[model samples]
Target: MATRTRRAPPKARTTSGPAFEVDAARLPPLGMPPAEFLRDYWQKRPLLVRNAFPGFVSPIQPEDLAGLACEEAALSRLVAHDAAHDRWMLRHGPFPEEMFPEMPDHDWTLLVQDVDKWDADVAALLAHFGFLPRWRIDDVMVSFAAPGGSVGAHVDQYDVFLLQAQGQRRWQIDASEAMGRTAPPLDFRDDVELRLLQRFNPTHDWVLGPGDMLYLPPGVPHHGVAVDACLTFSVGMRAPSAAELLGDFVDTLAADADDALRYRDPGLAPPKSPGEIDADAMERVVEALNLLRMNDPERLGDWFGRFITVYRSGGQVMPGEDARSRIEVEWDLQQGARLHRHPFSRMAWRKAKRGARLYVNGAGHALPARDAARIADNAVLDGPLYASLSEAGRDRVFELMREGHYHLDLRQDDE
Candidate 1:
């Protein structure tokens, strides 16, 4: 195993600079150095970072979020609380525009998932999360809540960073006990649509203003309520369960498995009881199943690369009716056109013996490791970098672009 090197703490900084730009060396959101945060807090404990984004202003407003909730493709929800009756109601969206005006002034919230895939400004916030693998990120979800609005107390099975974008919200968490093997079994209330905690006892409570942030590890039960109308951005991580991995892995194996392979027992002794399953029969069964086991490391790696790049949701990115030719792409690049990655498409890379395998939206391409890294890390293919690509790399990129993993932006050239 390679040893981790400890470095001096990083100096504090201001707002995350520009869209799709990252300075991995200086991460201000964590309040501590990325390495230290990863070591001491990542998936291990809950942390409250004050003024993580000092003077931060929301790029999108509540009206904008409501507008997005009206779109058919957007995954959204509205949660309303009836305080008088102590009742909670849940409704899924593409809500009509008129629904907002009809809603009660308080005790309601609108939440939109995968806002990063729909809005550039929301996606830009992802650049700040360079400390984690790109594939591990699910999406940036934005929530707009009215005064006294809440989703109820619940425990998430994945890590999350909650950043206050506007106004103020109160957060309470049960941090007296960390979640692990020794932690008590969790119980939920079956009365409501959401999986709310049966009982909640908060050990920490605080109200967050704009620019403040709260980080919670998986299985940490927490609750949040809007102190006033506010907008909050949730950066959530993806954690695939063992069953999900096994199911996908088996599918891949079956796709490439040999049909001719069969169980054989050439030399066998007669059984005293023909109906009974003897020890020898069980041994052969185990031996037969062993043929289906994954023995090659490269094959396993490739399957995992393809599996993770799809994340939880797939088929969001689709090819256009008109496909651009390689020549057209080349001409556009020469004309100062840039290539933008489809926000819904996930990318990741791994080193291979020959070079590296770049995985994008569940597709893999072999390229030089350096080139693979560049493609996986940069969402936009700029003029200089496009010029530097090898013929093979460029060809792969063109194919990917044609398949809708990326699109050409010609506004700059037109200007």
Candidate 2:
């Protein structure tokens, strides 16, 4: 099979707004000293700026965004209301334009979630915001709202930055603590709208034209209604809960284990009435799971990194012919070849054992080592963070990166 070549990093396009510049010089240095705007105001409160991206045009056009919504494979939703009846409805799509003729023009929205799944251009736009660790990076979700379209008062569990690419939107934000009381029902309808008890205007509210941006911290209750046809890109952070981690980690363990780890029924005898799962059995199962989680920290990190990197997108990367041939080659750690985690990926923990070798995406290799510094550095960095490696190391790293099993150092691209 033909292998996909790595595309050259695209040139950084200039935008007009000074606030939107993400270069290192433009950003506040570590410690986020008291004077920095982002350190002082971000997520703690709402920030609105006019001309944030001065010359910024919508990365993806509204029509194109809509076109994506019409694909059966796309994740899209339509929110609409009948002003005459004061009734609201949400529809999932594959939508056709004709569905909106009867609804008032400005009272609805068509949202295309996870734009990164469909548009590589949008994904690149997301990459620019990777100031945070890539492992915490979440997918980009885009919404095209018509006039007066709103998504009711809601609070997200993770941080989000709302970037206005075109038109204007009126946003209302409130303390996230008020969410449980103010939030509309999961199935809330227009007739029984959950009312917000507290409200705050954008301490910096303004008509956001193309390039404007708003950053909101998780748990902040906010609502947005378009004042005109608008396109909004929501760059959200991923905040996985303990339950989600347990589910995925457990699934990974089950896949790796050849022996069935089924709950053993002690076959206990007679009580007056039969009951659901016994307490003793439950304790045994929990103990077994705890044992699994308590693997050597370094080994755990290697396994978790490989598991996360390979399945980050819910897609699998199978070995190719070249990969099969190169499987047994010895890798040089001193030369600096390393398997780096995806920016947004997360690890439950790390556990290392003797002779523990990591098979990335089930194709690439990360040889085990005894050096704590090297292991930590290699696992934590998004791409390679070390300096130049020996030619053999570079070749090995290149082959893995080429196979989409790892990411090499950014500087190495020039070499």
Whole-model Cα lDDT of every candidate shown, in order:
0.82, 0.55
Query: For model 2, how does the per-residue alpha-carbon lDDT over 156-271 read when each residue is reduced to its tens digit?
Result: 87778778777777676543232223432333233534333233332222345556666666666667888788889887776777787777777777776646555555775675
Q: Total backbone clashes of model 2?
A: 19
Q: Estimate each model's TM-score.
A: 0.89, 0.61
Clash count list over all predictions: 0, 19
Largest lDDT belongs to which candidate?
1
Q: Could you tell me how far off, in angstroms, the CA of residue 400 lies in candidate 1 after the best superposition?
A: 1.3
RMSD vs true structure, all candidates: 7.8, 11.3
lDDT by residue (tens digit), candidate 1, 1-415: 1221222222211213211112222347776788978887787777777777877899999999999999998999999888898789999989999989888879998999999988898899999888999889998899999999999889999999999999788888776454222453469988898898888877567677787788888988899999889999999999998999999998988888899867878878988998998888889989888898998888889899999998687238888654677787778878898999988778999998789999987888999998898888899997788878888778788878877888998767558
> Which parts of model 2 are misplaced by more than 4 Å?
1-46, 49-51, 97-104, 176-206, 253-290, 310-364, 367-415
Q: Candidate 2: lDDT of 122?
A: 77
